[model samples]
Structure formats: C-alpha cells, structure tokens
Target: MNKRLFLSVFFLCGLILSSNAQEALFGGQNITSPEVHEDGSVTFRLFAPEADVVQVTGDFLPSVKIETQMGPMDGPGKADLTKDDKGVWSFKSEPLPSELYGYSFIIDGFKTTDPNNPFLIRDVASVTNIFIVGNGQADLYRTQDVPHGTVTRRWYDSPGLGMDRRITIYTPPGYETSKDDYPVLYLLHGAGGDEEAWISLGRTAQILDNLIAEKKVKPMIVVMPNGNVIQDAAPGEGNKGYYKPQFMVPKTMDGTYEGAFEDIIKFVESNYQVKANKENRAIAGLSMGGYHSLHISRYYPNTFDYVGLFSAAIMAREDATGKVYSDFDQTLKTQMDNGYKLYWIAIGKTDFLYDANKEYRSKLDSMGMEYNYVESEGGHIWRNWRVYLTQFTPMLFQ
Candidate 1:
C-alpha cells in the first residue's frame, strides 16, 4: 500500500477503536437513585451486581433501640433491598414526612453511600447520602426563590486559646448593600462539629434566608464558631491538615472554649456591621455547643440578652477545670439578676440529656429565672435542633 493510504487507514482504525472504548466505558449507565415520588415515598437504588445481601438504612424507616453509654436511644432502621434480574438492588419506602433524611446502603455487611446520589453530608467521621422531601419543615432548609445571604469562612484571633481560629459567618440578604447594623446570633455547633457543621448539616443559611424572607425572623448575622478547641476549624479546612473527626475531642466541655468565647465576639464586632450591644446579641447551640452556650452566657453575665440551648448538655462535670466552669450558681444568679430578654431551652423527650435539661429547668424555676422551655418529639438528633433553631430565632431581638 502507498504510504499516504497506510497512514490514513491507521488513523481511521485508531478512531474506531477509541469510539468502541468510550462506548464500553460509559454507554447507557445513567442512574437515578433515591427518586422521591410525589406522594413522599422514596425509592432507593443501588447497582451492586456482586452483592449477596443488600439493605438500606435511614431515619425515614422505623427506628430500633440502641444502647449507648449514655442510655438507650432510638437509631435508624434498616430494610432489605430486593435484587432484580438486572443486578440492581432497590427498596421503596413508605410515604415519608416532608423532612430531610439520610441513608446508606449495606452491601454484604459493608456500608456505603448511594453512588448515584450527589447530595451527601459528613457528620464527624461518618458520611451519608442526604435528600429532602419538600413542602414542609425541610422547605425552610431548601434554597427558595428569595433574597439570598452570603456565607463566608473567615479566620479570627483567639488570644486566650493562643491561635487564630476559623468561623463560618452568614450575613443576611441585603447586608452588602444596606448600611444598617444587624443583630448578631452566635450560633454554635455540637461536639465533633466545627465551623462547617451548621452551614452543612443544620442548613443555617437556608433557614435564615427563608425565615427572613417570610418575615418570620429578623435579618441577623449568624456567626458559627468552631466549638472544638483542639482544632482550629473543620477537618481539612484548617492548618491541622486532614484528620479523622471524632464524636468527642479533648477540651470540648472543659470550659476553656467558653472562656475564649470573647475572642470570637471581638472579631465579629470589629469586622462585621453588627449590633454589638446585649439586646441585639444572642447565643445558642446544640449538644456540646449548647453546653458552651449555657456556660458562656452565664460566664459573661451581661453580654448576651438572648440565650438558647437545644438538646444541651446541662450538667457541669466535676472534672471540668476552668474559670468558666467555676461558680456556676453565682454566675447564673448574676445573669438572672442582670435581666435578659429571652432565655430559651429546647430538648427532645427521648434525648439522653432530657432529664438533665429538666433538672436545670427546675433549678431555674427555684431561682425564679424565667426561661422559655420547648419539648420536642425525637431523641438527640439534628431534626430537633433544626426545629429548635426555627422556633428560637423568631423570639430573638423582638
């Protein structure tokens, strides 16, 4: 054959082979897992052909009793998935409520997220696929067609802690354009959570956006500080580099965090256009964050006019060593005497800390300290915290 003809034939054969390779690699493999139907029923699918047994676990299913060091609590339920002839395993759940749910697939004793689902969130070390059933409380968590806010990850100097820590701040809509000073809500996260927890798992930005748009709550600045004193920020976001997150970290409830809370306050007041006075300032948190909020609010005594504790760890540990943990009764009494606009506490009935909260409330009652108490229906979970945020913010700075 001629040289020109041979080269042309060789190029054409290469093109044909490349086309076949592309077809074999990615042809006809479009999957839609966790399809939410109109009736709120969800169908989860996993294309695991080599799996002998597959099960789907999520909060949407019936819960099972789980025993932990704290107590017996309800845990996510699991259901077996049926394998089809095409080697795809799937399970259709009953009509779920209009809320957010997390799920993972258990294939032959191995747990994995839904590969086809793009939406997922990491809570500490464990990550799971997430989805929302719209038209209810979750709608507030969803980004709606309304004026949006700006979320920024900023660093601040914590003088007491001797390090520059990171915080997640959410400036409300029209913040950039308006010259008005906004109220600030110091929203905190639970243990094992850092600056990113409220923004990612709690959906703080979305909730604020929807609530402010509907005029349900005041347009305020949300400052979410890293509750973990051991780390400067969330995993991989700080100079600590990537490390496995744990549910309990050192110095979490030891009052050093509460003592250094002023650093965060100083940074926000100096940087953002916020109302720095006590009346416009609010502090709230969930779990360990709630514990920090309670201590910090009392320790400062006159800094925050509004305080909220959602599923908060109300007990002060005997081993907790710090000035923040010292003189709890005196500081709390001083705070009560200082006269705050709102002191709100919310907890789920099944939460391990429910009795603690109740005992704390009884203490407040004996001391004649007025606080708004809200009891919810679930255990120690994010759903109740989100609900508490929705209910608590509206009562602030009114």
Candidate 2:
C-alpha cells in the first residue's frame, strides 16, 4: 500500500479505538446524579454498572455533552455516559435552590428516573417522572400539618377536540356544603399529558385545600381539562394523526378542532352547579395549556374573563408578535365590550419561558392591555405551576 493509504488506515484504527474506550467507560451507571454537599459546591454521581451510556436530563440543560470526563458523554451532559470503576457514576449538581425540579436519564431517547428518591410526580397517563425537592427542612414534610385537598376523578366529553376525555376537578372545602355558585377556574394540562395530570401529580387540589382551610384563598371550583384536542391512550403512544391537541393554535380555529373547548365549557356549566360566565369563569394552564388559555380565551371571548398563563410554552421571540397581539386584541375586545377583568401571567425565575413571558408582558404593555405577571422560584416543572395557580386564585372573581 502507498504511504498515504497506510496512514489513512492507521487513523481509522485510532478513531475506532478511541470510540471503543469511551463506550467502555459508559456501562450501567444510570444517567441520574444525586445531590451532594461539600462546603458550598454540590456533587452529583450516577451508577450505571451495566449500561453503555448515561446522561443527566433536566430543564436546566436542554442539550447535552458539555464535557468528556468518562466517555463521549462522560464528562458533562454526555450521551455516552461514564461510571466510576465500581459501577458508581455520579457528578455534582450546580448550585441550586431548595425548590423542586424534574430530571431523568436518556438511555438513547428514552427517560429513566432516579431510584433513590421516593418523591416523584408522574407524567401524563403515568408515563414519565419529575423530581420534587423537599422544602429545605426535609423533616418538616413529616411534621407539618398541611391540609390535603380532595381530587375527584371525572370524565367530560369535549366537543371541541372531537373526543371524550377525563379530567380531575378539585373542589375546596365548601363545595359540597351549599348551593353556592362559586367562581370556576379551568386548568389545562401540558403536552403529552392528560386530565389526571394536575390531580394525580400537580397536586392542585391539595394545595387549594391547605390554602382555603387557612383562608389564604377564596373558595372556588377548579376545572382541569385535557388539553389535547385528540384522545391519548398514554404518553409516547397515541392514535397518531387521527386526533389533534387543543394546544395547537392556528391562525384561527374556524374550521378546525370541532369546537372541543366549547363543549367542555358547556358540559361543565350544565353539569356542575357553578357560576358560568365571563365574570365567574377563568382559564389557565402550563406549557401547551398556556398556549391553549391564550387562544381559547381569545376564541371564547364571551366565556372567560380571567386568563392565566403559567410558564406558557409560547416564546417572546416566537409568540410575541403582531399576529399574536392582534388575536389578543380581539379577545380583549370581547371582554372590553362586556366589561371583563383579570389577565394574569406567571413563570419561574429559572423557567425556560421566564424571558419569553417578560417579553410577552412587554408586548401586552405596548398594546395598553392590563395583565398581572409574576416570577417565582422554579423551572418548567409542575411544582411551579401548582404554586402559580395557588397564588393567582385568591385574586380571582373579586
């Protein structure tokens, strides 16, 4: 062989060797790392003793592979995750607050949760996992007398989405007591989630119970709707394209969606003995549901007076624009024509949509639209959305 060809072969061999070495480092050390404290710095470690790759997954890091300590993905955010010599794979977490967050390991594109922590929020149809941080004083969780809310499993047919879906409605203390028509707040779940989400995982009902019993919030009815326009059997698996999700906001839903949202409202109004009108009704949601509230409120301007977007999936750069504002104007127009009130937006300081919500708020400012915006401690997880609803409800229907 010629000299050049021989050198090329050698280079190829070297590359294969390097890749093999990295793969060897990544075996069975699950990608998830545990919280460690050392003076001030936090340390994280993963233990995947029988796997080929492991990388930490969370909202903080959208991408992967920041370093190459173990394998191609061994150092930091690597897919070819690495483990210690004794099947112990771990790393120190960045300085973080005592608030809750979600994380997992992507063995390929699939996600896996931590085995050590028992406290977790299950995802839609019980498919995935999210980590809940103990409220600083871990023992307080055991001793605190937190009043728990009641979650009732209910089903409603959504004419807007063209399907039948289940939802969880959380009624506070006085719901079953009297013939009072309490204000209603319609809560929407995120993409790849279902009606059981907020109740089973988000814990909206429990928070309300604790708050209302303490007189922290006014008594009201919380209506959680399944956001997807189409029905989902579970996460990652569905009817494919035969159905649509409610979160998908088009230029308009004139011919699309089959008015699934309206059906939801109608069903609730007819069935539940609750005040049903712009003044007595509100809509709010997280991620995709945030998008739903904005669009749904716009579409059903006569229906909802108060609108809340919790860590809305819409981006300032992507959603804050003329068309969006124009649609918002139309929604506000209906409310203004009818003397409606309350438009609130909230997101976590560490949330991905933090900056986006600010920009959206700025847009709302430019349009002379009145809205309430808030920033709390968290990221794009249910923990933040839960508190956001808890804080925003007391101020509603006043």
Candidate 3:
C-alpha cells in the first residue's frame, strides 16, 4: 500500500475504535443506571471516564449541604461512587422506603442530573432526577388506572394586581360532559414555588383522582394560583413570553397578596360551573401558602367553609406586625360561630415550622375552636406535603 494511504487508514481505524470504546462505557446494550430491585434497593451507574470523582445525592441518602437563600441548607445526603476499570461509576443504596425521591449526581463537586434517567423534576430554580421505590406511599404519587383529571395552564385577569396572571386548574373526569356543579379547592404553593408546584411536586391530581375513584372524596376542582404579589406568573412566563426582568424581585411590589385573593375567587366562580357558596369552597396551602391561607380565611371568613394548612407558617397577631390587628379576634370568633365544616392543620414532627404550628394550635385551643390536627413523621419536605394532601382531600366535601 502507498505510504499516505496506509497512514489515513490507521487514523480512521483509531477514530472508530475510540467511538466504540465510548459507547461501551454506558454498558453497551443494557442502559439501566437506576436498577430498582424488588426489595426497594436502588443501584445507580454513571459513565464518566474523565471525571476525577462522582457521587450521588438524594433524599434517600443523608443530608447533602447546599447553599440556599437562608444561608446553607442541608439537602439529601451524598453517597460516594466507586469507579471500575470500564470508567463507569456505581453505587447501591440501602432499601429506601416506598416513596418518590429526587436525586442528582455530584460530578467533581458540581451538581448535575442523571444523564441516563429521563425522569426529571424541575423544582424552583434547579432540576433533579427522580425515582420511585416499591408500592405504598409511592403508589399514591404514581399515575394509577383510575380516572384522570385535566390540568391546564390558564390565564386570568387580575384587576387587583393590574396584570393578567396564570394559574393551574384541575377539572375532574366528567367536568366537561356532566352538567353537575362541583366544589372548588383553592390550593396555594410555598414561597419559592409557582403555580405548577403542586401538580408537579405535590401530585395533587393523582391524589384527588385516586380518592375520588375510591369514593373517599367528592369530585372537585382544584385551582393552583400564583401567590407571588409582584410576579404575574412563573419564571419564563410573562408579558414577554419569557422570564421578565422583575421575576426575581424580593416581593410583590404591586400590593399585598391577601388583598388580591378575591380576584382569584371571582375568576373561578365566574368561569367554572362550581358551587358558588362558602360551604362548597375550600382553601389550602403549604409553607408560605399556609400563611396566605390563614390570612385569607381570616380576612374573608364567609368565603371558605373548609381550610387546611400544611406545614403552616402561622404567626401570632403580634408577631405578624408590630401589634395585633383590631379585628383579628372578632374574625376568628365569627368564623367559629358561623361553623366551619373542617379546619384541618397538618405538619411533620421534624419540620422547621413544627414549633410555630404548635403555637398556632395552642391559640386555637385557647379560642375554644374546633380544628383537626395531624402530626406525621419526617420534616418540611415534599413527602409530607403529598401525604398531607392525600389525607386532607379525603376529609373534604363530606
């Protein structure tokens, strides 16, 4: 063979071999990085020949320290990965409880989603890979064979805020065909959450669907409204059709969110064929949303007959402002006198807001009010929130 031809052939062969070697690192044909076993143990795999080190961080593991607005918050713990001669890193986790978990790969100190897993959840500003283990609580988060509801990213006029806003709405299976009017659940999200938080992270639709299918709860419409006072919608959704400049503002500059609550109620009542009375209306929220639910209920006692606060950040009237609001006690007494179908409060024992929840419960006790209290295991995480929703929805509209 000619000398030049021989050199060209050698270079082409080397390139092909390198390509094949790269492909082999991903386990050739079998691409199951997270192989969940029958016993609920999970094995994770990654192919990073050039990486110096790799680790897995998830809720199933111990708390991994991550920076947050409130200084540094401990996220799920980290598990070191062992590398093999094939340039593949792997780790097998202990049997995790049956529930949905969010995890990410820490490749050389930087957080990244699993390249092998396509199931990812977007939370606040970051994204993480997710996996489910066994049945039980995990089954509630999964999409079952029961009737499903329709979730819509809808726009509504917010005259109070002077801008059109977006909200997530869930209409049950027969909402369109049947002429029957349904009760409405105005569900709110946490401080950093948007309208999509509940449907994506909380699994509101699945919980309601399963409960309604089992006849444990009546069919109802769930409205997830954006509670941010300034931002009209979630990130990347505004007048520009993308993230607007004011999206990251410290707080809503227009007005207080409590004052704007009526806009949402009016929109739902006017648009949907829902029972437009206090008896058929319910309001619930988590974290910051819990605070909103508390204030909204107090501000307009005649608007909601059912109120739920999950991991609520309830504050004493003095703690809320410099002094107590004059009408606060009267409003509470009036609401109790009018009679509420259900005033439920649920919180995890380890939650950061647990103490505050206790304080609020004490106040309720002093007022001689009737409310249901639920204390579960775990902290202020999505797992408890999902469980609270499952427990709360079933007790509604009875």
Candidate 4:
C-alpha cells in the first residue's frame, strides 16, 4: 500500500479507538443522573469518583441567605453524597412536597450541574438543574396530555425608550381557529429577571395549559414584557452584550416605564385579537414588577379590573431627590373609587418583603379598599411565585 494511504488509515483507526474509550469511560448513553421514584422520592447519581466529596444543593433543601443586587436571596444548602464501590456518588432524598425545584451538584468545592439531567433553568447569573415532584399542584407545571399553547419571543418598537423591546407572549391553545377575542393578562417579572423569566423559570405555559384544559382558568393571552427601561431586551439579545442587572435604577431614568405602558397595550391590542376593556384586562407581577403593577394600576385606574402583587416591593413612591410623591394618597384613593373587580396581594410568610407587604395592606385598610390576600409558607423564591401565579390566574376573568 502507498505510504500516504497507510498514514491516513492509521489516523482513522486512532480516532475510532479514542471515541470508544471516551464512551466506555463516561458510561455512554445509559447514564441517568436523577431517578424519580413513584412515591415522590428522588435518587441523584453522579459518576465523579475522583472527587473527594460531593453534595447536592437545591430549593428542596434548606437555603442560606446570600446578598444580591435585589436584596438578600435564599440559596440551597448542601446535602452530602455517598460514594459507592464503583466510584459513583449517589444520594436519595426524602419524599418532598409536590413542586418544582432547582438543584445542582457540588464536587470538591466546585458547583456543577448533573451531567445526566438534561433539564435546566437559568436564574439570574446561574444555571441549575430542575426537577418536578408531581401528583398535586406540581402536576400543573408539568406538560400534560392536553392541548398546549404556543410561546413566542416577539419584538416591538418602543419609541419612548428609543429602542426595540422583546417580549414573551403565550397565546392560548385555540387562539388560531377560534373567532373569539380573549382577555389579556400583563404579567411582569421581578428584579434580576426579564421577559423570558416567567415562561422559562416560572413554567407559565405549562400552568396555563393545564388550567385551561381542566376548564379552571379562562382561555386568555398572557404577555410578559421586559420591565427594565434602560435597556430594551434581556442580556445577549439584539447583539447587545450581557448587561449586569441593576436594581432600583430604571425608575430613575428620564422616561418612566409607566408612561410607556401605552405602547405595550397598543401593540398587543393591534397584533392580537383581545378583549381590550377594563373587565377583561388584568395586570400582575412579582417583586419589582409588583411595584410597577401597583403604580400602573393606580395611574391608569380604568385600564385593568384585576391587579395582583406577589411579594411586591411596596413602599412610598419617591422622586429623584428622595421625597415621596405628593399625590400618592389621592391617586390611590382615585384608583379605589374607580371600582376594580379584584385587587389581590400574595406573599410568603418568610419573604424578605413581608413587612413591606404588611404595611401596604395596612394602608389599604385605612383607605377602605377591599382586596384579596393570600399568605403561604416559604420565602422569596420561584416556588412561591409559581404557586402565587397558579392561584392568581384562576381568579381572573371570572
């Protein structure tokens, strides 16, 4: 054989051998990192025998308070893993509540994700593996055998901000064929979040799908808009580099988001067939978005009949110079007189904003306004937000 042909054949054989060795070392395609049992228990496995120690961290376990841009945030604590004779680290968790939890593996002081689990979610600056413990409310977050809706990442011109903005929209399952005009829910996200936060980390689509299929919630259109007024879209979109999320800064910008709210309303009404009226319109948000919802509903009293604040960052509105707005009380009074269908507020007992929400409720009481209040057990986390959404959406358009 020619020398050149022999050399080429030798290289090809070496490549094949290398591929086979890698497959054998990593256990090939038969690896299952997280094995969920029928009784709600979970077994997590990682093939990291070389590591000195391994542990699992997730929302299902206790969390340690860590300071963030928004405020003190809760992060999962570590659960140690046991290594077997085959160099595989494994841990089985006790039966947990029915909910969606985000978890990660810590190997030798390095935080890492489960290579065997394909499901993951991006939260703020970190990406963590997610798993759902079903059989109750969590089943709502899971994809079921029902008709599913479509989630689209759409962009619209924002002349006020002088840029184009991206939004995540969810149209109900029958939006295409049905001639009926559906109601609209303008759902907002918290700090360190963008438009995709709800649909991605909050599981908005799955919850809506299950609720609509079960005939529990009205088939409506859900719109999630970016709350940041400084930048148009989320980080890494529209050729923009990753922007570190800033808190309590957008409100100081020249243009107020509330003033630009009309643009979103116009875009949605013109683009989608929606019942654009007070009775059919609703606005709800979590954290900073909750603050926006409160101010927006107050500024435009006749726009939304239903308003919800989930662990809202509620306090007196202040100007650039740190003075409270003069017309705050009157504006809220006027909004209450406008007669809303349902003004709802929800918060976890251990939420960092619990005191703020309590103060806001006291103000509501003094103003003689009626609203619905829901209190649950937990802190400021996605688990509570998802629960709040599941409960709040059903009370709309009723």
Candidate 5:
C-alpha cells in the first residue's frame, strides 16, 4: 500500500478506538451537568453531540411534552440544547429549586444518565442525583445530624428476570434494641436505576436520621429494591422508540420469587432487629418505584400498613391521560379506605400527574377514603421526593 493509503487506514483505526473510548467514558449516550446560579433556579445541561435530538427529562420537566415545563420548575421552557463547533452537544435550561433532581438524557431516541453528576442515585435504592440548590439539601443532609440508619447491599435469586440481582436496605438506629414489631418501608427504584438509588442519590438515610433525631419523624426501617424486570441492559438500547418497558411488571409481584415480598420483608426482619407488623411495615417509592409501591402494597395488602407514592403512576388513567389513581371499585374501595395507618401520596404541583392527583383525590372524596396527601412546589424530580420523604417519614409510627 502507498504511504498515503497506510496513513488513512491508521487514522480510521484511531477514530474507531477513540469513538469506543468516548462511549466507555460517557456510558455511550448522553452527558449531563448542572449549573447553580445566583437566582433560585438551577440551570441543567445535557450533552449528546452524536445524538440527533437531546431533551432533558426529570421531575422538574413535565410529562406532556419534553420541550416545556410540566411540574414545579415551571419557567425556562424545555428547549433543545445547542451544539458547538466541537461537535459536542450542549443544552441549557433555567435554574431549579434546591433539591435532588432525577434527570435522564435522551439521545438518538435512547435514555442515558449523566456521567458528570456526582449524585448518581439508582432507580431503586438511591435512584436520583443530588444538587444542593439553595433550598433543602444543606439542612437536610449537611447540618442535620440525625441518627444514621444502616445501609446494606444484598443479592436476590430471581427466576423471572433469570438472574441474580442486587438490593440495598436502610435500618434506623435502635432497631437492634427491639425485636418487637416495627414497620418497614420498602423503597423501590425507577427505570435505569438500581438498588443503590435511595441511599446514595436521594440521601435518604441522612435525611431520615436528622428527621428522627429531632422528633420530626418516626424512626423506621427502609428497604430498597431493584424495580426493573431485566437484570441487565437491553440490546440496541442506544436509539430506541416506544416506552414498552412501562408495561412490564416485576415477577416478584406475581409470586415468582417464592416469598419475594417476604424475602425482602424476612431478610429485613431477620437481618435487622426491627418490627414485623402491618403498622410497623410501610412501602413507598418514585416513578417505577412509585408504581411498585402502589402495586406491592395493594397486591400484598397483608404485608404493609403505610404506603408512599411520590410523583407515581398508580392510576390506570394516568397511563392513558396522565391522570392520577382516583376511582376505585367496592372491594378495592373498602381496602383503600380502611387499608393502613397512612395511605399517602405526595407530588409536585407542576408534575404531569397533577391533574391525575386532583382527580384521584376527588375520587377518594367520593369513596370517603381519608388518605394523607401532601403537595409541594416542584416537578417530578428526586428533590421533591427527597424532601417529601423527609416530611413524610415522620408521620409513620406517630
């Protein structure tokens, strides 16, 4: 081969290697970074140069459309990020409130999380990223030295997804002091999230500690689980359309794990010296986890007493029209109305589920089910859910 041809071949190989290296570094999809401004808002940026279209999705952004605000971060529309000469993609938005935000990047029709953000909470245990905006993070995680809970990672044998999976747990202090029945809060993860979401990204253990120490909330054991059906990443994931994954439910819910709920419940019950009653047992989560919380508690009503669904998709109507779970039949009605100590739901005013929440509440009114509902000012991000947990947990065991 001629020298020029040899040089060209060498360059092509280097390009391939470089491209592969980039994929490894950025996890092959989108890049995200946050800018905390002087204003109350925290501007968010996601980089996806190779991606045709990159839009930001999180609790702060609404569900109706990607280019606009749906929930709390109402202003600073959801516009596309501009590309620079470097072929590096960049999109910027206005500031967000101080809290942990759950965001994912969509590139060439695929979902990706930020590689830059230090706050990568999983979809299950600690499933969101943390940005200490001007609001609650410092007080919640920094200054507040509440009693620290025990965070443990565990594995489960699964035949449904056909693999071994990981899970994490959070046990309150003094849990070892009592073998008596105490409630357990089974926390679930969101999509593209894992067993580490709650403790790491959400900073839930610290928040719970501070809240418990101050007598603001009751001390309870928190359990985090992986919500995804498949144990590993899907094939051809880089650029895919359709949210078909939304339709699948974990087999644990269907009794595939042979005491799946109890496996966790028993694992938690045996591992930690805590309570084992309906009143002492609670379950909750966000997004996929939120749906998990709603379904698990309903499906296994005998297991948990308190159920928390944050910006969750419990109502069937929400699946069709972005509405909340409101209407219920008679047997379902009796169960919901007389279910537990607290059948709770908290969400953002600016979330796509806002109307759904309202509709669900109205239906609750019709059924005379007095569920405890709290509404905050924000979108569907972890910031809202983290703060929601901080405020919501105290109500338990009270």
Candidate 6:
C-alpha cells in the first residue's frame, strides 16, 4: 500500500477508537434526574461526584421571606441532597399538590438546570427545568389526548409605536376548519414578560386546549401581545437580536402601551374571524399587564364586556401621562356605567400588590360598582397567575 494511504487508514482507525471510548465513558449510565412517582412524590438526582455540595431549590418546597429592592416577599425554598456511594446525589420531595413546578440545582454554589430533564422554560432571563404533577389542575397544563389548539406567532404593524411587532395567538381546535365566528380574549402578560410569556410560562395553549375539550370554556381566540412598549417583541426575537431579558424594561407601565392597545385589537379583529362586539370581547392580564387591562378596558368604555385583573398592580404612577392615564376615576366610572358581563379581580393573599388591590376595591365600593373578587394563598408568582387564567377563561363569553 502507498505511504499516504497507510497513514490515512491509521488516522481513521485512531479517530474511531477515540470516539468509542468517549461514548462508553459518558453514556455508560442512564440518569433519570427527576422521576415522578405514583403518589406525587418527586425524586431528583444529579451525578456530580466532584462537587463539594449539591442542593435543590424550587417552588414545590415551602416558601421563605426574602428581602428585595421592592421589599420582602416569599421566594422558593431550598433543600440539601444526599450523595450515594456511586457519586450520584439525590433528594426525594414529599407528595406535592397537582401543579406545574420549576426547579434548579445548585452544584458547588453554581445554579444550573438538570441535564437529564429536557423540558425547560424561560422566565425573563432565568431558565429552569420544569415538571408537572398530574391528575388535577396541572392536568390542564399538560398536553393530553384531547384536541389541541394552534399557537401562531405573527407580526403586525404598530403605527402608534412606529414599528412592526410580534404577537402570539391561540385559536381553538376547530377554528381553522369551521366557518364559525368566535369571541376573542385579549390576554396580556406581566412585567418582564413578552408575547411568548403566556403560551410558554402561563401554559395558555394547554389550559385552553384542555378546558375547551372538556366543554368548560367557550371556543375563543386568545391574543397575547407584548406589554413592553420599548421592545417590538420578546428578547432575541427582534431586529436587535439575542439580548438578555430583565424583569423591568422601559415603558412597561407607562400609558404608551395602553394608548396603543387599539392597534392590537384592530389587528386581531381585521385578520381573524371574530365577533366584533362588546358582548363577545374580553380583556385580562397579570401584574403590569393587569394594570394595562384595567386602564384599557375603562379607557375604551364600551369595548370589552368581560374584564379580569390577576394580581394587578393597582397603584397609581405619578409619572404616567396621556389620555389613557388621565381622568382615571371618571374613565373607570364610565366603564362601570357602561356595564360588563363580568368584572373579575383575583389576587394571592400574600401578593405584594394585595394592599393596592384592596384600596382599589374600596374605591369601587364607594362608587357602588360591583365585581367578583377571589383571594388565594401565595404571592406574586406564576403558579397563581396560571390558576387565575384557568378560572377566568371559563367565565368569559358565557
């Protein structure tokens, strides 16, 4: 054989041997990091023999009060894991309630996701591994054998903001196939969230799919628009490209987003086969988005017949300007007088905005306005927001 051909053969054999050795070493054992048992107990494992310490933190554990710039609030709990002789660290949680939960592993002081769990979700900039304990409400968050909805990300012109923006829309299972006109629900996200927040973190599509399948909720279109006025879309989804997301962005709570709310409505109404009437329209949101929902619903007066505010930021901002924020009491009074099918308000008992919501309720009481109010146990968290969405949707267009 030629010298060049012999050398090439030798190199190829060496490469194959190296690849096989690496695979054998790394893929020798299958690690199931999170194994959900039959009784709702969760066992988490990590194979990190070199780490000095390993811990787990998640919403499934009890909450602890943590001090933040916004004040003290309840945050996720943490627990230590035991390392076995095989260098695998593991911890089993007590039987938890039916809910979708997220967690991260702290290996030697560095926080990271479970490599074995491919299911993950991004909340603002922090990405965490997620799992669900089924059989109840969490079942709605899961994709079952029931008919599912279509989630589409589309772009529309926002002449008020002078740019094209992105939005996430969920149409019911038979929307495309049927010639029927459905009612519309304008679902908005909280601060630090974007158009993708509801579909991913809030589990909007899954909830609608399960509920509509069960005949609990009416078949309607859900429109999720970016609440932040500064960005045209979610982080890494715009012209600027791949920037880290933060909890607070510019123009989030300002009147600009509320003033331009009509743009989103127009896009949805003109493009989709929707019932374009007050009785068939609804608007609801969480946190900052709730603030927008409150303002926008009242600002338009006769637009939406159903309004919901989930853990809303009800405090007045001295910096806010424009017609949307102006004459707040009168606009709200106008909204109340115009009437609605359902004016619902929901908040967690420990939510930081609880006091603000209470004050707003007092004002409404003084004005002789009536609304359905519900208070659950928790803080300003996504778990409560997801619950609120499920409860609010069933009450719309009924």
Clashes of each: 0, 30, 5, 0, 48, 0
Residue 297's lDDT in candidate 1:
96
Q: Candidate 4 clashing pairs? A: none
Q: Per-prediction TM-score, please?
A: 0.94, 0.65, 0.87, 0.91, 0.62, 0.94
Give the better candidate number (5 or 6) by lDDT. Answer: 6
Q: Rank the candidates by lDDT, best first.
A: 6, 1, 4, 3, 5, 2
Off by over 4 Å in 3: 1-30, 64-68, 71-74, 240-249, 252-255, 316-326
What overall lDDT, based on C-alpha atoms, would model 1 receive against the true structure?
0.91
Q: Give the per-residue lDDT digits (tens) of candidate 2, residues 1-398.
A: 99999999999999999888866665423344455443222344556577666666664333333332212221113324457898766655555544444566665466676665444665632333343345452121221365544567666666545566666677766566568787788888776666767765666666666667667677788888655544533333344543333323342223233145777778778877788667888888887778777776766667878888988855323443433345556665666465558888888776656777887787777767788878786566665776686677778887
lDDT of 5 by residue, 1-398 (tens): 99999999999999999999988876664644766667755555654456677766665554443442223334322445566765655655466556545566666666666666756544322234545655545467653545566777777555444565567777777766655555667777654455656776678788877777877877677877766545432212212332333324444233232224555665566666666677787788876577667656655656667778888765542233211223235434656755678888898987767787787678778878778888887666666777777767877876
- State, as a TM-score between 0 and 1, how close model 6 is to the true structure: 0.94
Q: Write the per-residue lDDT of candidate 1 for residues 204-299, one digit (tens) a residue.
A: 999999999999999999999998888888899989799899888888888888888899999999999998899999999999989989999999
Root-mean-square deviation of every model: 2.6, 13.7, 5.2, 3.2, 9.0, 2.8
Best lDDT goes to which candidate?
6
lDDT of each: 0.91, 0.62, 0.83, 0.86, 0.63, 0.92
Ten-residue region with minimum lDDT total, candidate 6: 22-31
Model 1, position 104, has a per-residue lDDT of 95
lDDT (Cα) of model 3: 0.83
Q: Order of candidates by TM-score, top first?
A: 6, 1, 4, 3, 2, 5
Worst 10 residues of 3 by lDDT: 317-326
| Model 5 global lDDT (CA atoms, 0 to 1) | 0.63
Better of 4 and 5 by lDDT: 4
lDDT of 4 by residue, 1-398 (tens): 89999999999999999999988766564567788788888999988769999999998887788886557867687799999998888899999889898899999999988888878988766889999899988999999999999899999888866888898999999898889999999999987788879999989999999999999999999999988777678877745787654444456322277768888998999999999899999999998888878878887878999999999987544443322233668978988998999999999988889999999999999989999999998888889999999999999999
- lDDT at residue 367 of model 1 (Cα atoms): 98
